[model samples]
Target: MKVSKEQSDANRAALVKAASKLFREKGIDGVGVAEISKEAGLTHGALYAHFPSKSALAAEALALGLELANKKLYGKSADEAPDLDAFLDYYLSTRQRDNLGGHCAMAASASEIGRQDEDVSASFTEGYLEMVRAFENHVAQARPELDSSSRGLALVAALIGGVAMARATQKSNPALSKKVLQGMRELVDEAGGLGKK
Candidate 1:
């Protein structure tokens, strides 16, 4: 039977939602198209109808995942207080570390993305730059006397690296893992407060 336009759009959305979560939980190469379709409660044929190729699906998925992350991390407008404390409290929490699919896409898939095609890499790069710009603006508000752009990049690097390290040591040295998160949070928080009178 021919699917209606509405149903087709719904099915496409479902696939992208499922793809975003699964691809973040598992790297782009970790999960396959068959698994994504199954997770979305659709067949492989339906998945293909929506996306031309797995890479295409993955690129979209990564973008969606990062978009969600950005919304979660930074609010809707530049006027919002950068809430670095809130970000640190949640991001470094054990809950965020445990939920791989719900965390930042970069921390989840940056390594694997480097090996993928240019489309996927480009998607990641674009999301990353957007995040940096947001962070820079926020940092500037918090600390006007310093070079906010450079500091913003450092802050992002610290957050991503801290989360990655925490996740990596989560199973082994849990204490060190917690310290990694706490330490990075402290450093970033201190830096943000540095230039304030």
Candidate 2:
């Protein structure tokens, strides 16, 4: 009847991973603790042992999702700047739009974060600022003439909004979804001065 520290850590990680994927696929409000526990191959009681409440688990899960996405976009090291063109292409692609459970947390849960607890909101804000800082560094290098901070914020907003809109219209209006992605990509390209000398 007792668990090792290693096993406990592994279990907690599993719970977070499962919760992150499920929350992205179905909104946070839509998932129950039992389902998350079941998905993680743990008991409902085990979930409580790791996290005080579902909201606590949700906050950790959201942080994990955002961290993973940032790593994917920016690479393992902070010194590495992402290629804006490649980032735009992948982010606005139908592939990312359709992969609900495996994309950025911001776009997946943007509509629901406003209703979540302060901890969840703080996690979202931290993740978002981390992304903006990385983007700001990249923009500063690429276009020193531009206000990197403002451009970074604008790029992130457009990227998150574009993906969310594309996903919302994907099933009911595929054409419009594609157009939305295209328009966002064009906007980013223009803003970043991608095609210019």
Candidate 3:
């Protein structure tokens, strides 16, 4: 009749994980609490036990997604610098483009975030700013001449926009989708001064 602390924590994690994946694959509005509970192998009542509402769960899920994406982009450790060129290569590839449920959260839900509640928007904004800070720090070290803040903002925007556009057109215009990815890659590389010695 009772649950252990460890079990409760695990259940909460499962709920957030399931919500993150499902939200990315299907927009937040498109998914229901029952589906997320089923995906997590928990009951609908269990979801409410951890989260007050679906929006609360969504906020937590988006935060988790962003954290995971950041770790994937930059390495796990904060001291290590991100390889901009390598990052571009992987991010722009069709593999990432086609992986809707596992790719960046920003790209997957950029259009939908504006319609969500403040908590969701706050999570999205914080995640986005964290990304910009990572880029800014990298630019400061790699190219002192360039404005780190400006370049950082630009690179993040380009990356998110690039992926979003590529995915959007992938079904209707495959060639254009490919071109969008390619163009954004070039733009990011040039803006970052990626390959210069």
Candidate 4:
């Protein structure tokens, strides 16, 4: 039977959405095409009809998840920051760390993507750079005195590192996790206050 174009699009979207959340919650290697198809409520055969390979599916899903996150954090354009502090609070929060499936895809899956094929890595790198560039532009606006490029890179690293470390220690040592969040927040606050002085 020939599937309608609408149905085909919906199925592809559902697969990407399910794969995005699952890929974040579990590393790329942790979830397979079968599990993603099952979660998306589509058959394994249906999944193949949409994607040629698991890597292809993963690359698209990663891009979708990162795009969603960038939209949430930075709005429609990279330069617009409706609420910078709010972004910092949510990003560095324990809640965000605990909810890996709903937070930063890079922090969750960068290590796994690093091990994947060139295409997958390139897809992730593109989104990752876009996100960092957004931060760079935001920092340039807020702190004209400082080197925005280096600061943006540092801020992105600290944000991802803080969240990753917090999640890692959330179970073994909750205090350390909290400290990671607090430290990053403090550093961000300091950076924000720099050009004002």
Tens digit of per-residue lDDT, candidate 2, span 27-75: 8999999999999999999999999999999999999999998887787
Candidate 3 Cα misplacement greater than 4 A, ranges: 195-197
TM-score of each: 0.91, 0.94, 0.94, 0.91
Model 3, global lDDT = 0.90
- Local accuracy of candidate 4 as per-residue lDDT tens digits, 1-197: 99999999999999999999999999889998889999999999999999999999999999998888777778766555545667777778788889989999988986687689988898888877876786787778877888988888777777787788889889999998899889888887787542213
Which regions of candidate 2 fall more than 4 Å away from where they truly are?
195-197
Look at candidate 3 and tell me the lDDT of residue 196: 27
Candidate 1 lowest-lDDT run of ten: 188-197
Q: Assess candidate 1 and give its lDDT.
A: 0.84
List, residue by residue over 1-197, the lDDT tens digit for candidate 3: 89999999999999999999999999999999999999999999999999999999999999999999888778777788776667778878999999988989999998999999999999999999988887788788778899999999989988999899999999999999999998987787677766324
After the best TM-score superposition of candidate 1, give how far the Cα of residue 40 lies from its true spot, in angstroms. 0.4
Q: How many backbone clashes does candidate 2 have?
A: 0
- Deviation from native of the Cα of residue 59 in model 4, angstroms: 0.7
Worst 10 residues of 4 by lDDT: 188-197
lDDT of each: 0.84, 0.89, 0.90, 0.84
What are the root-mean-square deviations of the candidates from the true structure over C-alphas?
Answer: 2.3, 1.6, 1.5, 2.3
Instruction: Tell me the TM-score of model 2.
Output: 0.94
* Residue 161 Cα positional deviation in candidate 4, in Å, after optimal superposition: 1.4
